[model samples]
Target chain A: MSDLKNNLPVLYSYFRSSCAWRVRLALTFKKVDYEQRYIDLIKNEHKSEEYLKIQPFGLVPAFIDNKSGQTLIESVSILEYLDETYSDFPLLPEDPLERAKVRALVQAIAMDIQPVTNLRILRYVGDDRKDEWARHFLAEGFTALEAMLQKTAKKFAYGDSLTMADIVLVPQIFNGVRFGLDLNAYPIASRLYQELNEIPEFKATHPTKQADCPEELR
Target chain B: MSDLKNNLPVLYSYFRSSCAWRVRLALTFKKVDYEQRYIDLIKNEHKSEEYLKIQPFGLVPAFIDNKSGQTLIESVSILEYLDETYSDFPLLPEDPLERAKVRALVQAIAMDIQPVTNLRILRYVGDDRKDEWARHFLAEGFTALEAMLQKTAKKFAYGDSLTMADIVLVPQIFNGVRFGLDLNAYPIASRLYQELNEIPEFKATHPTKQADCPEELR
Candidate 1:
């Protein structure tokens, strides 16, 4: 029950989707006033015919910038769009080299860590060994993430300022924790995760804070 | 032995690795003068101590820009860096929305299709069911990709011009074909794939053209 004529950006998201959470974080960090339309991923709402029309990929975090009439799908693409279209609190660094570094970290988590452990992938990995699978890959990806963070991190994953690296890192850490991963093994990543969690931008957009989060999970 | 003191950028790559192939395409398309240093993934050379220093993630396609003193990992990030750093034959569209569409298609292949079927993941998936898993996910991801291309495509995945979408599509189609996927199922994607293969930039940087490609495969 939404109108593109409203001129307010609407985000189709699920409370617990990590990909969805990354977009929510970018929007909140950019301080963009937006409306959220919950799409229950568990209910296969994303796979609906109507949803597929809006997002050909049938994924959460399809963003509609009503003013620009740009309906963007894919979290990485949506994030880059938000950063490009909005001026405030840039998600990426200004210099192309620095931006590449930050993006490298983003893909390390987004492509390497999160996608493999996603709900659909987990289901395919089989029920009995899913947790083991998630834990192993999460640990493996994080081992390299920690090494990269050790080389680049200061206050955040990149430098003192927050970039896409931190935006990608925080939610991925949440997933790692969900898989019961031991943070102690990755000291550098563990420290950044703890510090990033304390920031208001990250805290406000946390999965538990979403309207659609179940009472029991909250 | 490669030296950082050399003016030319050194690309650590594997001949058959799709992730590495993406960067090679970007570099070739941009017409940048560079040197290639193969990291044999099958031989576990990527996991070697020296290779770990170059790419802590132990992945191929780690690019070192000697002029900028930037060492970049991740093929997506590397391609963006090449496009941003070298201006000739831009890999992305000038318009922000157009760029997002192109990038969205890139991620649809890079993240959704490529990573799940990567060497490491396939090994973990077990030999018996690995092809089944890869074929299933590839088909699922391609279905969405075909739907997206149907709306936006003309000669390329986005428009008549070459963009990142075509770059991503060419390599993924290579992977899909290697896995015995039927290109006839997705007409739009199939057409783009056929068209992209005709381009010299894509043809020159193809996996089979790499120095490390096996004699029979080449």
Candidate 2:
């Protein structure tokens, strides 16, 4: 275990969680160096006594700022905290109206889409039904997201320059691809995903590229 | 249809949606009057051509401010917008750190719990497995929430004053009770839920109290 006295931010993450990926992208974009502790969700290590103290929810991507002695859960909250504390690359717009717009778009994906297709929720559907459930929900959410993107796309979800929305969209699209959902129906989203996937922050944090990602997924 | 030219704030809502209920509570708390337009989720009214123009996602509680012509979806965003624009009872704290704590608590309930138990996701789980899935997921979420509440509760989720966290919590706990989950395990949550339920803003906006809640649910 890394010494808490070092005062660096530590992220407890799994290799493949979209929620975890959001923070990884944000930290990389801001150029913050922090230690990483991997929690193997497949092995249920997240729920063990040691990990549970850090994250009561047994969710990955709990960020610990040893400097402030602050531990934050919820991916979006962590993203905002990092942006506010670091103040390097402004992840959210300065104007409150624009901030609300960015937040609404991010929440659209975070609250609406991610929870429905998360690994734990999929497991509840049983193995035989998991893929079907994943495909069905992803399609339902993507249809709406595609419509929003088609109407709102102006370089990114709101305008030029990456915001919290882009951070959320890329990983979700990655998951959509993993689930074999057709992207032809969502041209704007597909284009944005293609563009964002090539960005250094996103590419560096890609699940397959993560230092901890297993060889098979890589 | 309310005239877009008029400066009225319009709320597109399904009477029983907890999300819509949250906005209603805020509007009432802020003493902001809005014309309530019912979108019958049960009858697929939200998916109708007319409603689709207003809300591409066909989700309940889409808020449109005719004055500014600013439209917003997502309950938390709407709550924050109202808090920012009106500046009445502050839904969030002024201090950035305090605001982060409130937001994190709200997101814990909104992103982590509510989406997983929403009607659309439940329907996707199919009737055969909906109850089991709902029960299991809600129980898991509440177990963690209960622990969080135990640590944070001081008359409210954060302290003596009510915040957005309370607004999100009441509806979720109401749903938890409706699903027959025992609240006895969560005294902190139970105490606060009982306390918040007594407030006029929350009481007036109770799901059963809504004009459109079905007879069966009532």
DockQ of each: 0.87, 0.68
What DockQ class does candidate 1 belong to? high
Specify the highest-DockQ model's number: 1
Worst 10 residues of 1 chain B by lDDT: B1-10
Interface RMSD of 2: 1.4
Give stretches of model 1 more than 4 Å off.
Answer: B1-6
The number of the candidate with the highest TM-score is 1
Using alpha carbons, what is the TM-score of model 2? 0.95
Instruction: Evaluate chain B of model 2: give its TM-score.
Output: 0.93
Candidate 2 backbone collisions, by pair:
none
Which digits, one per residue and each the tens of the lDDT, describe model 2 over residues B94-206?
76666677778888899989999988888777788788878888889888887777666798898778888998898888877776667887788888988899999998889
lDDT of 2 by residue, A1-218 (tens): 25553667788988888999999999999999887889999999998998887777899889877656677888988887888788888898877667777887888889988888888887777799888888887888888887777766789877898898999999888887787678887888989988888888888899998788888878
| Each model's fraction of native contacts | 0.91, 0.64
